[model samples]
Target chain A: MIRILLPAHLRTLARIDGELLLAIEGEATQGSLLSAIEGRYPQLLGTIRDQITLQRRPFLRFFACERDLSHEASDTPLPGPVVAGEEPFIILGAIAGG
Target chain B: MSKVRVLVGTRKGAFILNSDGKRQQWDVSGPHFGGWEIYHMKGSPVDPNRIYASQSSGWFGQLIQRSDDGGKTWEPVGNKFAYAGVPGTHQWYDGTPHPWEFKRVWHLEPSLHDPDTVYAGVEDAAIFRTTDGGKAWEEMPGLRGHGSGPHWQPGAGGMCLHTILLDPSDPQRIFIAISAAGAFRTDDGGATWKPINRGLHSQYIPDPNAEVGHCVHHIAMNPARPGVLFMQKHWDVMRSDNAGDSWQEVSGNLPTDFGFAIDIHSHEPDTVYVVPIKSDSEHYPLEGKLRVFRSRTGGNEWEPLTKGLPQQNCYVNVLRDAMAVDSLDDCGVYFGTTGGQVYASADGGDSWNAIVHDLPAVLSVEVQTLP
Candidate 1:
């Protein structure tokens, strides 16, 4: 089980209250986790990343286990605590003011 | 009893204001899609219940939302807006070749006949149409494929195709205006287009009479007289009688011609309205007094309508897409300002009242008259 936490706007868009728990089939990588998340909630297909380029949006970051994984390769395995459901992988919006 | 629903898109969210035929009382329902910039929301002319909204964010990119129940419920649809082929380059601010990029949708114009079809005017200057409501969008690349596209440059605002006017008399004829690319018309549907700026003179460009570098703010035409088009250009109010083949300046007896929003009266096609701002550098109303100028003679002669509008200490601006008209018997005129006030005139432009006092600096206003 992989626990993931979305930003406030994404949570409102996906209509989920708290953290999302997903069952990963293979290695818990960013690519596989995003694919699974988008497959489950199709409305979030292009919110966190670009649909055509498949690049993460510049104003969004991925973090887990008190470290920034935004620059990590999509195929790289997530932190052990995130994959084991001990700590939730977090997708946060930049702190830029509106 | 007839009803009027005003769809207002703001920097923060979308707001829907409902009122009866009298237009005395109102009901506000919103901050829908809260915390996101709702650039434009418009209802289909054929089916008033069907609405399309452009929702975007700096952090999340762009998303299109549709409502079958008149905005009561909304569902996110397809947001993939890829260019047709190799998206070519356009002139950048420094006159350098810049790759075209999709930023966000600036306007949405629903089809006049088909509820499922809508046209989206996006930045980087292109038009996309969705036939399955808001589910899928395909670029109509003919507009951007014109010969002079490479020289097109962005206006003070990004290079945005912010105006899309559909001709009701002839289904095959469509008119679209970009920020600094001027306006173009398509005679054979969306397959081909030609620049329609013949008599436009802009001092900002090297050649004052260039065909494709005029910055048109907004264009309006009453469906009754589709051939007669009125334009609020970057510095002049113009009129084109031969369907934009040639234009002549109609900015007569007006204070300053620099403005943004422009619209025609619902019942009176000859009556035009415009809000004159200070200048391009100073966007506020002149002398801190907000007033709406009306020209009943189509142009040349004008009068300032200020029955209820602020005459002093008002420094708000009306955007290009922030004005609209309701086609009731009396003809209601409405416009939203940068100060977050939506002022409406139930009986044309004679009187005004703020339907919504504060709403996150409105970006666009659209009204639908319900039977």
Candidate 2:
């Protein structure tokens, strides 16, 4: 089981309260988790990643176990704490104050 | 009681302002979809309860929100706006071959008689229509496929199809305006189109009278007189009496003809209004005084209407889609400024009042006259 934490706007869009628990087939990777989440909630199709280019939006960042994982490859395995559901993988919108 | 609902889209969010026919007091609703750019929001003419909004952001891409209860509660509709077929290419900034891409929707023009049907004008200069109340969108590629695709260039705002006007008398006819692409008309109802810029002369282009590079800012039409059209081009104020077949300059006796928005009085077809900026490069009012010019004689002569607007050290700009009209017994003219002010003129641009003084920088303003 993998627990994912979406940003506030996405949480309102998907209408989910807390962390989302998903069942992954193999290793808990970012690509597989995103695909699973998009399958579960189709409304979030291109909000996190580009629909055609499949690139992460510049203003979004990914983190897990208090470590920045946005620079890592999508197929890389997530930390053990995230895979074990002890900690939540977070997708945050980078903040730049006006 | 005749009520007025003004749907305002801003850089930060969307706001709904409700008022009675008197237009004295207003009940402001929100900054719904907060922290996102609300490009445009419009209500259905057939069904006043239905409203559609173009919401987007750098982080979340694009989203279309539909409100069935007239700006009360909104639900995200289908945001997938895929261009039909190969989608070809147009001239980029450097005159290079640039492929068409869907960045965001700039306008939402609901059908005049059908709430389920609406047209979306998007950046990259394409028009998409949805018959299922924005649940899905299909591109009407005839506009871009009108044989002038490769020559169309982007303006300072990127090539955006920002205006859509449906002829009320002739349901088969429609008009669309794009930045740096002039104006186009479709007589066969979205199957085929042709450029209708005959007398438009822009000094910026190499050929001052080119057919498809005028950079038309906004166009307006009166339902009673569909043959007569008013346009605010990049530099001059123009008019087309023969339904956009040919245009003539009517920018007589104004402080400066360079402006963004244009509209006609709801009751009078000859009564037109435009906000005059100082120049194309300096996008502020002349001499730090904001005024709206009204042309009662259909074009040659003009008069400044400035009753309650700021007249001292004010330098805000009115965008292309930021002005709109409400068709009540007394015609109401409304416009929003880039400095975050929405002003309303109840007595047909004779006097003005700020409905909301400070919001975000407003992108578009639309009003629904409800019975």
Candidate 3:
């Protein structure tokens, strides 16, 4: 089981109260996790990333295990704690704009 | 008895105001899609119950919300707006080639005959159509494929295709206006287009009468007379007789012609309304008085309709897509301001009342006359 924490607006969009728990089939990478998340809640398809380019929106970031993982390769393995489901992968909106 | 549903899109969320034919009292139901920028919300003329909203945010990007039950409930549809083909470049503000990007949708114009078909005018200046209601969108590349598209540039409000005017008489002919790119017309459905901007003299641009590159603020045409079109350009009030073939300035006696938000009356084809702002730099009512100017003589002669509007220290700007009219017996004129007030004149700009006092800085206003 992988735990993911979405931003407030995305959480509201997905209608999820707390963290999302998804069981990964293969390696627990950002690409695999996001594919699963979008598969479950299709409404959040283009919210966190561009639909055509599949690039993370400039205003959004990814973090887990007290490290900034947004720049990491999408297929790169997540932190051990995040993969172990002990620490949740956090999808955060950047602290900018009014 | 017939009622009117006013769909107001604001900087934050969407609001729906309902009132009977009287248009006196109102029941406001909103902040729907709260905390998101509702750029435009419009109901289909063919199916009033079907409403499409362009809900977006700088953080979450763009979303299309569809309401089948007349703004009562909404469901998120498609948000992907991919540009066709290579999606080449247009002139940026500094006259540099900027790659065309897909931004948020600025306006949604539903089909006149089919509820499932709709057109979207989006930022970065392009048009897209969705045939399956709002589930999917495909770009009509001809508008951007025009030879002069490489020279088109953005206005101060970004390069946005803000106006989509469907020709009621000829279904194949459609008119769309972009911020600094001027107006374009397509005679063959959405396949091809031509820039219909002659006699438009913009002092800001290099050649005052250039073919393309005019910042048209807004354009309005009565469906009854599709041939005659009225435009509120960045600096002048213009009228076109031969369906955008040529334009002539009709800004006769107005204080300042720089303003946004123009609409024509429902019954009377010659009757038009425009809220004149001070200037493009100072986007507020002149002399701190909010007055709606009506041109009954089609454009030259104008009268100020200022009965119920604020005449004292008011500074609110009416955006390009924030004015609409209901086809009721009395022809209600509605507009929303940057100060978050939605004003409605039940009797065709005779008197006005604020249907909603405080919203989140309205971006667009659209009305649907319900039976």
Q: Residue by residue across B1-371, what tens digits does model 3's lDDT show?
A: 99999999998899999999999899999989999999999889989999999999988899999999999989899989999899889999889899999879999999999999999999999999999999999999999988888989999988999999999899999999998989999999989999999999999889989999999989999999999999999999999999999999999999999999899999999999999999989999999999999999899899999999999999999999999999998899999999999999989999999988999899999999989
Ranking by TM-score: 3, 1, 2
Please, what are the lDDT tens digits per residue for candidate 1 over residues B248-314?
9989988999999999999899999999999999999998889999999999999999999999999
- Candidate 1 local accuracy as lDDT? 0.94
lDDT of 2 by residue, B1-371 (tens): 89999999999999999999999999998999998999999999899999999999878899999999999999888888888888889898888989998889999999998999999999989999999999889999898889898889888988999999999998889999999989999999899999989999999887889888889999999889999999999999999999999999999998888999999999999999999999888999999999999999898799999899999999999999999999998999999999999999999999999999999999999999998
lDDT tens digits by residue: candidate 3, A1-98: 89999998888888899999998889888999999999999999899889998889999999998899999888998888998999999999898958
Clashing pairs in 3: none
Looking at candidate 2 chain A, the ten consecutive residues that score lowest on lDDT are A49-58
Using Cα atoms with residue i matched to residue i, what is each candidate's TM-score against the true structure? 0.99, 0.96, 0.99
lDDT ranking of the models: 1, 3, 2
Superposed by TM-score, candidate 1 places the C-alpha of residue B283 at a distance from the truth, in angstroms, of 0.4
User: How does chain B score by TM in each prediction?
Assistant: 0.99, 0.99, 0.99
Docking class of 2: medium
Model 3 lDDT, residue B211, Cα: 96
Error of 1 at B18 (Å): 0.4
